[model samples]
Target chain A: MDFWSNFLINLVQGLTTTLQILVISIPLSIITGFILGFARVYGNKIIFYISTGISTTFRGLPLIVTLLILFFGLADLKIYLSPFWASILGFTLCGGSYISEYVKGAIQSIEQGQAEAARALGMNKLQEIIYIILPQTLIRALPGVSNEIIYMIQYSSLSFVIGVKEIFSVAKTFNSLYFRSIEIFTTVAFVYLLLIAIATLVFKIIENKLKIT
Target chain B: MISDTILNVVDLHKKYGDSIALDGVSFRVRKGETKVIIGPNGSGKTTLLKCLNLLVKPDKGRIWLGNIEITDPRININKIRRKIGFVFQDFNLFHHLTVLNNVMIGLVKVRKLKKHQAYKKAVDALSTVGLDNTLYHKYPAQLSGGQKQRVAIARALAMDPVIMLYDEPTSSLDPQFVNEVLQVIRKLAKNGVTSIIVTHQIDFALEIADEIIVMHKGRIIESGRPTELLSNPQNILTKKILIRNFRTLR
Candidate 1:
């Protein structure tokens, strides 16, 4: 009975930490991703090369390596960031790379004629992007972006490595304190599954409402 | 004479890599004239029209519309493009937007009209093309070939351009749907809008075009009023092509 109650408390704490990371990381990653994506698409050769390099570099490196490098490197700069912030930044960097490709591909998939038609209608470049291009790109990119969000949710478990008391970290703590590894780990796994299921349902509703394929 | 020249292309030359698409192509489209360009495949008819609209930049020569010379690299192409309308062989309507919104997009975003005013103009344009009743809320995919082409026409007309360019507009439509689009073009011509059309429909061109230009190998082989040129073939290419193909129409 005591083991069951302890497991419940740790699982709840883990769920709270997971939710907190998601709430901050997902939106920040999206905004940064979109901006970098547009830069990759329309920017000059130099800008395109630089952004592509950054995105590819982060995407190629392992997530734990990136997290360790950032945590240690930033500490060396004498600007010590919290474990939560470090993990957030690491995940965002990784997420931004994938998200940029999604956005770039979505923008490119739009018909060239659409832009031509917009130009023929007297829209300047900026107006053309905002009114015609962006709306269409957003609709087309929803599935890819949603997939990225789900990946981010799963990967937020990596926050445990940097000593951020995220779901897995809380689980680990409960196991060490109470020697209830199986119960705590199982509960944590179920909570993660529930979070993902809920998110998928919400996003699916939005996708259907928007009529995005 | 000066004001009659609505669009004038002088020695326009455009090359893609090593291949010359438009080699010294020149023409004058007077106000309210419906000119048809007919040619075998690989001629520069479509490229010529794209140059006039600044869609394809010319490698040499100049294009003049009214008093504005459009060859200056720093000049605003979008402003000049606004005055010209282009329709493609494939009806390039925004499939995502409703027919009404497709027409209204240019009016609201480019022309900066209020939403109410843009909607009114969109309705007026649709009505002009006789599609006001069937497609106010329908998407392009829901429309037939004829309806889709009409929506494309409505989209261009919503901008109220001074001259319209049609690049084989009816070439992609089914035989039954072709007449509906041609009829709309005839109506536009009758209303005194200058139009330059590239088409393979010899009979339809005979009925609607004031002047017919026969192009072969990137140059105009024969050009005159349709009655004069079709009645008397001057070049071997024109003779062979028209004699071989247009006997039924003739």
Candidate 2:
């Protein structure tokens, strides 16, 4: 096939698979991260320790190691997950930890006065966290969370390693058939750039809407 | 359950590290009466006001807000806090919320009022402090210092607390903005909200206080009617503050 025909065929397959994984993983990681972050800060001693331990452990381990362990090790226990599921599980484990750090930092940056004011108003602990602290925290966490999504766009390429046939894997197959390393890789870079640009624009609109200062 | 005292503090003591912030301080506020506390910067006046609502728990003391023992570990402090409104020095408005929401949050979250009911109360409270409907939607950052403080006052007032505590409510404002906040506070006291105010504004205290208490080194040195206390202060510290005030004003 000609270069244009080859590129177009690989692009469709690669981009679609990459987006499918990201579309589901991003929301799951964000929700999981928020709960973990809140638990790390507000939970009882046992819960706080457990949440902090999980985030710390995941953050320290390399993503590839986690994926290898999860994909292969699970089989020994009679649990079966496809390459796609393995990629998602690994990325979520890593992404959830990073997002939790962002959320925890955002919550900490809020002044002590906000909590005091909330309590003085007669809000119970749950109500204070839900109505007052969480709204402000999410607003503060937006820039960090946006950056995390951009990271997801880049890191989704890692899914190719597990034979998930994401964009990078498709690019690799296309390069093998055509023997065009420079051209194929350059196109992949631009595809990521395009995704980042779109992400940036979406985040900018959200940041403006949520800004308190 | 039926008590004329709006607040009572007995043998209140708090120490930070090696320093004593409040030492055996005691006072009582009757229903609908204003008690203005005056003192120098390190005099523990702020600590005393905070301990009333258990904002800063006293190391050793008993605080009674009506019939509930606020300092007791068994009591739900949140319920006690709602009945005793506190206006902070820095306004402490929720920066993320609009002025209306700032006033309404306590009503909705604490009082558990319906949104429309909370809305009406919020508007009434805001207008009570002279904030018009036009500024209701504006955020704290968009407001002037006086306006922000009024919103803070409105936030507390919307709860309809039986007692209000003011901790230098005008302390953070520009001189031009101070009078507006002071005026709103005076109106609350006049309209029969029991109050305990801590301020350096001696003239304003004399104008509004039903009783004036002078604090020095974590102790009440003099307590009496504003005129008598200011005119014939017995303690050297109170006399010094009074002399300084008169000299500056004259």
Candidate 3:
């Protein structure tokens, strides 16, 4: 009943931490995805297989499993990362693997003639990828990338399992102190709904504005 | 004095598994000459154009574009490739880019020209293909096949290639749309642009080619002026293919 007075500050703080994780993870995921996908398609056999193996390993594992391994396994190797950084690393690895598939698909979906024309024009391999291939890949991969972004928003809550004081973690505190399961979860549900709404709207605008000619 | 030789290929050989595509092919084209290659389907016509740009690597060959040995592993190929423009049958314009950017890409990216300079050259190339300013902003999907093909030609020509190679440029066009493309090639030939065109057009070949090279199975069966080849009938495959084509048109 007095939820705002008691829990509003922590809820907002949790949301801010969740967003911080997102900002760091999303860009990292995209760059990793592009590099992995490009390597898989065009790199020499060794690099291509390495990228393939890494992508497969990450994509095969569940996100929570990855988080646990990153968080705990690192300590065994005499490395340490805070729960925040661990979740960011885990989520990025997971997102990058999924996004890499999208990128590879986009690259492959493009007609081979496109690259041939670019090369025939005397553009080198790097120039071809930058001008002819990368632009089209971004456009083609938009829908897939945005879908991953949405998945990321929901999965950001998984950070709570790593002792991250993110959205669900804040909600858990409120649920326990208030002894009001229905109200606490309802508010949490609304927060998630609102996040999804904003994510969907932003991606829709981008996809419409930037769809391939 | 500039060497009259614009392109020279020496004993080019290529195969895909068991099938040989180009079998010991050799030829030379002079500056300002138009050489048309007439071949049946799957006779390595496209492969030959692709090989010229190193898109399809040959098993054995030496290709010289002027003094530059394109086949040499040491040379920077991108520099060599820029001087040799290639147009594909499918009009492989970048579908995501505007018709203008399609032309400007090589200029901006490969030539590293400033945007304004690239735009000016791109427009000039498009205008040469009879694509006016109005169509510059259009996408490939927005244009007719003829227009897309012209845009493709513009994209290639904007590079200012020393020699142009067309891979069955008109093969994908409708009967009604064929002349517009052929007409562009005709004008280019008349303007003394050195070019090698691979096509099924016997009529266009006779009209425009200074030398027509007929390929059969996988080798150059005959290479001569249209008048001489038609009059003398040297190779049976050349005679058969040309005669059949002429008969269909009439």
lDDT of each: 0.84, 0.88, 0.89
Extract clashing residue pairs from model 2: none
lDDT of 2 by residue, A21-106 (tens): 88888888888789889998898999999989989988998887778777888977988888899888887878888899999998
Say which prediction, candidate 1 or candidate 3, comes out ahead on lDDT: 3
- lDDT per residue as tens, model 3, B171-192: 8898888889988989988999
lDDT tens digits, residue span A9-75, model 1: 7667777877888899898888878878888998899999988998999899988888887787789
Error of 1 at B108 (Å): 0.8
Best by lDDT: 3
Candidate 3 has what TM-score?
0.96
For each candidate, give the TM-score of chain B: 0.96, 0.97, 0.97
Poorest 10 consecutive residues of model 1 chain B by lDDT?
B241-250
Tell me which of candidates 1 and 3 scores higher on TM-score: 3
State in Å the error of residue B106, model 1: 0.7
Residue-by-residue lDDT tens digits, candidate 3, A166-206: 97899998888878888777888899889889988998998
lDDT (Cα, 0-100) at B14 in candidate 3? 95
Residue B170 lDDT, candidate 1, scale 0-100? 91
